[model samples]
Target: MAANILLTRIDNRLVHGQVGVTWTKSLGANLILVANDDAAGDELQQKLMSTTADSSGAGIRFFTLEKTIKIISRAADRQHIFIVVKTPADARTLVEGGVPIKEINVGNMHFAQGKTEVTKKVYADAKDKDDLLALANSGVKIYIQDYPGDKQYPITDDLLSKVE
Candidate 1:
């Protein structure tokens, strides 16, 4: 049984103030799942993010990519889950692993050495572009939105081409 997935977001910062409070309340999600291998293994990150979610009155859990695939696939219908992953590649893995992600919010990719600016809040490197293109090809509706009230920019081929 698939869980009642409220939102699937790609934010490099994972669970932060905006996501833990604003998005949680807006979506009415009861649980926040941080699906990142690094956060899963780092107790400090887990603790910090857990604190953020707790403040928003949402249950929080950290899981590796594989574990996330397994758990989310079998999640109970009553579980209103909000999944947060760090990268487009991770989101692609979840979708390919049968997590039933239909649409994805590209929240924040952040600027990095090899990345090109896609939007004010989104930056993508070659690998990120490839992974995101793969997801789009697979029928995932990908868009960029920083907050709940922000404008959504759909990731089109024109947008991707402009990155280079």
Candidate 2:
């Protein structure tokens, strides 16, 4: 059917306070789909996501990247979905898997051991930068927006150069 996927975001802290309360309401999303292999397999992580709860009263589901890609076409027909993955690589995977992702928001990707800080809240390693570049090349509008009212910074070659 018609594509109902609204916003696909890459946030390391998936379904947290900002996402649970702010983005769901802003996007008018009825479903929050968390596509992450680690969180999908861990009951504790799932439970934590639930405990945070979508203050906007949206439904939340967690699935592995493969399962999410497989079911996305069918799921889109059912609701306005907001898909969140932990990394740019996962977002790239979804796009490559034929999910009609029009745009992707890079949100909070906290400091990691090997990742270099690209933006205020975003950090990227070599692979992350590569995946982001791939998505941009594929014609997806890539933006760096941490919160609802934050100014969106478009992903460009100049921005990509800052990844180092």
Clashing pairs in 1: none
Q: Candidate 1 residues 100-135, lDDT tens each?
A: 888899999999998999998899988898888888
Candidate 2: worst-modelled 10 consecutive residues by lDDT: 47-56
With candidate 1 superimposed using the best TM-score fit, by how many Å does residue 34's alpha carbon deviate from the native? Answer: 0.5
Candidate 2 lDDT for residue 77 = 65
What's the lDDT for all of these models? Answer: 0.90, 0.86
Q: Give all TM-scores, in the order shown.
A: 0.96, 0.94
Q: Which ten contiguous residues of candidate 1 have the minimum total lDDT? A: 155-164
Q: Which residue segments of model 2 deviate by more than 4 Å?
A: 76-78
* Model 1: residues with Cα > 4 Å off, grouped in runs: none
What lDDT score goes with residue 140 in model 1?
87
User: How well does model 2 score by local distance difference test?
Assistant: 0.86
